[model samples]
Target: MWLKNLNTIFVVGYPIFVSIIWITGGLFSSFYRHRQSRKLLTADEEPFVSILIPAHNESDTLVAAVKSLAGLQYQHYEVVLIDDCSTDNTWELMETLAKQWAGQLAIHNLHLPINQGKASALNQGAKIAKGDYLVVIDADSLLQPDAVTQLMTTLLENPNYGAVTGKPIVRNRSTLLGRLQLLEYVAVIDLIKKAQAYLTGSITTVSGVIVAFRREALNEVGGWNPAVMTEDIDITWRMYRNKWQAAYEPRAVCWILVPERLRGLLKQRQRWSRGGLEVLITNRRGLYLNPWGQRGLLLESIVSNCWAILTAISLVAYAFQLFFLHNLSLDGNLLILMFTLNAIQFTIGFIASQEIAQLTLPELLLVPVYILYYWLINLVSCIAAISSYFVDPQRRGTWRSPDRGL
Candidate 1:
């Protein structure tokens, strides 16, 4: 009798324990690095920065997007908006913005005779970028006033920090969905990133909206390639392998629009998922038992991505216990306690993210219950990965933001 329910405990408890372990390690690591990141704020001789904006057809918000950057406190910078063969009036918009901010922003209005993709567009923009640092942002994103100054200052203080990412706040989060994203943004834009900072100071992904890297660093990797679906992630990994550490400065924030509708959300998530898989497949060697780079960061990435597989194994054991083992009567107290523990963990995440301004109160509270809603993203990503594995898109250089552009 005692042994009958033992299988259930073993099935669930182990994975839960493992998840806690992962979070705990990340949390402690983050706590330590938060201090280090803060110290990377020495008065910089505001480095020259070339802001890269690659758009397909972001006619709706491209002007406002450029306006945010045009007024950066750091006077030594240029905004280069690349037009990636848009059928819309996006090129016209870029032309207008270029002239309007003529001296301040050196607009690299590029229309690849054919639509190559964001990767190509960024490469094109980077080729002409004449700044000490290269900063990339999406068309729907806007930077904070001090964003440029903060980023350069951070790097100036931390010479070892090859790339520094700013915080991403969900802009136009007026709707329920938008509000949800705004709420969720805080956790991701801050806490988790903070955790990633200490674990290896080598985050696997960087927000395109606001990430600045040394020009030489990008040159070292030979620029963005179409092969890497998620050019941002690919670049981050490359920086790590090349012994370039990354830092996250939540103080430098950018407001970005989230996919307003479900369809848009799916497309956006699919792209991210597809890109993640592509990154993993291409850089698997660099991350796993590689001779180069810091060991801790590689280990963290491997564990995080491999968590899905680890969870799958536990679920399999749970299925067997319930069906074949006929262990229909598991202890209620144990189950309750285990779930409550998970609840506490989720609460901590909610509290952490919420306190850090990443998630809304409701989103944090609802994170567990919204399994069907959010889990679909994981499923879709898996699907995208499968699709990419078989039929790789024709080096489609342009990345269509989930809801915006062509």
Candidate 2:
């Protein structure tokens, strides 16, 4: 009876919980958009911004990415390119670019002796950054023409906003995997962020692809935590804990390359999952204390972590029963219900993609494929993350160059 009740929670409760979050996200997103349309964003003066591009074995795409930012409409900004001990010719290329675009672009280059991970490199850059705001950009990210202006303007508008993250549009969508990821980013990531921002006035993770931070807030939180794998996420929570606020600027879009192969995608997802778990584990005290009304955010984290664990256990038990007991019968209603819930989610995602991502009607035809691909990949990655946590909990958060789909 206990086993049956537990299975019911996994099969039914999970989907119901997901539906609530998605629906809430949709409603909140709509409200946010409505409210935002009424406001006029006027910039009295442009704040000095420092763009921090951290690269590690990113030679193939670094130059193009940097070039894209050179055309940013924002006038008062400098680019600081940090090569985190790249084994390849990344630093050499950066040095060349710095010399060439010296006057045109106030570009500076920094090379590290050893690869101490992205967080450390960002910290070193922050120490020397002369701008009032520090904008972190991934080496493979192409910022939109007005990305800098949009980000800085948003930050300037609200002094409470400690950091602002831009919308990351997947650029390389030629392959099937890339296309699926594009949909995921738009339908899933984009919508959820909007909703989270509206409901809690906070988001789970800041898009590390391109995000701007005020120097004051950065100093208050002591910058990025090198101990965590996802420095973006770590810093976001830290900002909240320190009485600082973060916001999402959907209009400030940054084009980024997503993993095109299954292996690359899985590795990326696993790392994200592991990082999320690490944050939740390390910040358990914050959840109980509920300082500054962070209980909602903390509760969301706890529920998500529990859901992952429950899902893993449920899957293993079901598989065991199926192999041992030939009498095992699949729950037809539960399967149908799951599919129905997923269809509802796909519809919400489709609507969001159309409005925010500007995805055409023809592109909507790939919804089913995306649903299957992402669902399966996420499940596998969840299991892998949980396994990694148990097996190597004490492992240091280190840098490993992901397959850039080059």
Question: Once superposed on the true structure, which residue ranges of model 1 sit more than 4 Å away at CA?
Answer: 1-44, 103-108, 287-372, 390-397, 404-406
RMSD of 2: 2.3
Q: Give lDDT per model, in order.
A: 0.67, 0.81
TM-score of each: 0.80, 0.92
lDDT of 2: 0.81
How close to the true structure is residue 144 of candidate 1, measured as C-alpha lDDT? 79
> Which portions of model 2 miss their true places by more than 4 Å?
37-44, 291-293, 328-331, 355-362
Question: Against the true structure, what is every candidate's RMSD?
Answer: 4.5, 2.3
